[model samples]
Target: MPSNVRHLTSAHGDASFEACVVPYLDAAYNLARWLAHDDADAQDVVQESMLRAFRYFHSFHGGDARVWLLAIVRNTFYSLRAKTASDAAHETIDEETHVLVDEQPSPEARALISVDIEALQTALENLPHPLREAIVLRELEECSYKEIAAITGQKIGTVMSRLARARERLKTELSHCSTEACRHDVR
Candidate 1:
């Protein structure tokens, strides 16, 4: 093997990078899923992001691995968008790809849940990328404003403004849901 070849373990026999990244795979997938809006595309985004993170592991000083990896996920998604607009434009989330907590709800109950999920996802999808990112980071991932700003390379004020606008847009778009979950979520 060439000296420059990267492996799962570091040169000094440390697996710190891998260790740091493994726990956040689901978080990475969730972000990618939200941004790409399609299962296959989200998988691609996460794979590329993981590769990039490994390739750049040496450059990472000590910090929150989740934040660092998520930033990479965001960049990978945007790069894909820039390179192939049409590939992304037509893609939508495939219901079969996601794991449901319910083992097998009744057909009618499943339909209702699907409708609720779709409404929420569509509202999020309708948001502009910046606003969507803000909302996802803050609301879903529960990141603080400072952390979002750090990951996004934006001023804290910009992050706050985006979150505010995203929330309002989601509230208006989700007005029809009126369900307890939606009500509890959009505030």
Candidate 2:
């Protein structure tokens, strides 16, 4: 290729990635964090995915940028997962780790609604990876079933089935939480 052609191609790729892929960075990070289950790992996944996306930018035709980036993120997370199984097995836990502190506490304690975010997070974390991903993509990320199917490389029907199963499991788990909360309330 000629030098100017090469330069223009590189510029096009850079502009495409910045315009199409960069906007989804936060959403991509959120997906990565949920999939990887660690902030550092999630960050690594997002970075690697973005690099891969940029390298392959020519392959991307105009479409939903968020879904395309998320697809890349999902694949990267799985690749990382496969490579880190042994490391994950021997990982140590700290008591203070993973504690979510609300930075700006809501001043409205008028009704004291019991949502049990910790329980929900635990339930989501315990779900099988496919189910968890389906839920995260569909519910949390507000992706359509078709979008999720493309991102996850699954058939739309399969995505629907997984989401249904995930919701059922979440309901079962959240019911247990509610029961405990009810008992505590009555006491």
Maximum-TM-score candidate: 2
Q: Rate the local accuracy (lDDT) of all candidates.
A: 0.79, 0.79
**TM-score, per-candidate, Cα-based:** 0.79, 0.80
User: Candidate 1, residues 84-132: lDDT per residue as tens digits?
Assistant: 8575453465766642658579987987787778788778988988999
The per-residue C-alpha lDDT of model 2 at residue 43 equals 77
Candidate 1, position 55, lDDT: 79
Q: How many backbone clashes does candidate 1 have?
A: 0
Off by over 4 Å in 2: 1-13, 87-115
